[model samples]
Target: MSEKQYLLDKTLETWKGKRVALAVSSEHSFTGIIEDFDEEVILLRDVVDIAGNKAKALIVKIDDLNWIMLL
Candidate 1:
């Protein structure tokens, strides 16, 4: 895997079940506990919208992600 992919893999592995926020290029963000991830996407549980309201879940494409922040 490339460096970026390695970093992502490490992040997913180390932060599993921890709350995090993903920022996208569209300026939208999703916050949730990491549920799972694959090559193309990530599964988030107990998600919250950008406005901070709770959501059941969120599936976000990996390519759309700009950054990840631990919360």
Candidate 2:
């Protein structure tokens, strides 16, 4: 696997079955369970909030991820 893929795999493995904070464009933030992950993106479900309201979100392309915090 490529270095990027390896890193993504490692990150996913480390963060699996955990909640993470996602920061998207427009400074939107959401907390959700990490349902699944791939080289390109992470699938999050059971979204709790976005900026301040209940919402569901799909984060595409790990490169677009500004940051992820396990909690």
Candidate 3:
């Protein structure tokens, strides 16, 4: 893997099962605990959607993410 992917993988490893928020767009973001992930995507559980409502879960492509931060 590239250094970029390696770093991201490391970051995700630390954040796994931790509450986090990832933005897909300026107006779109989701909050949840990281349930699983790979180089391509992340699975978030007990999620709160951009609309601020409960969601069963969210699966986000890594390339589509604007940012991710601890919540």
Model 1 ranges with Cα > 4 A deviation: none
Best by TM-score: 3
Model 3: lowest-lDDT 10 consecutive positions: 21-30
Model 2 lDDT-worst window of ten: 51-60
Across 18-42, the per-residue lDDT of candidate 1 in tens digits comes to: 9998887778888999999988998
What is the lDDT of every predicted structure here? 0.89, 0.77, 0.91
| Cα lDDT tens digits for candidate 3, 1-71 | 99999999999999998999889856688899999999889999999977889988889988899999987
Error of 3 at 36 (Å): 0.6
After superposition, the stretches of candidate 2 with alpha carbons farther than 4 Å from their true spots are none
Error of 2 at 28 (Å): 1.3
**Predicted candidate 2: what Cα RMSD to the true structure?**
2.1
Deviation (Å) of 12 in candidate 2: 1.2
Local distance difference test, candidate 1:
0.89
Pairs of residues at least 3 apart in sequence or in different chains that clash in candidate 2:
none
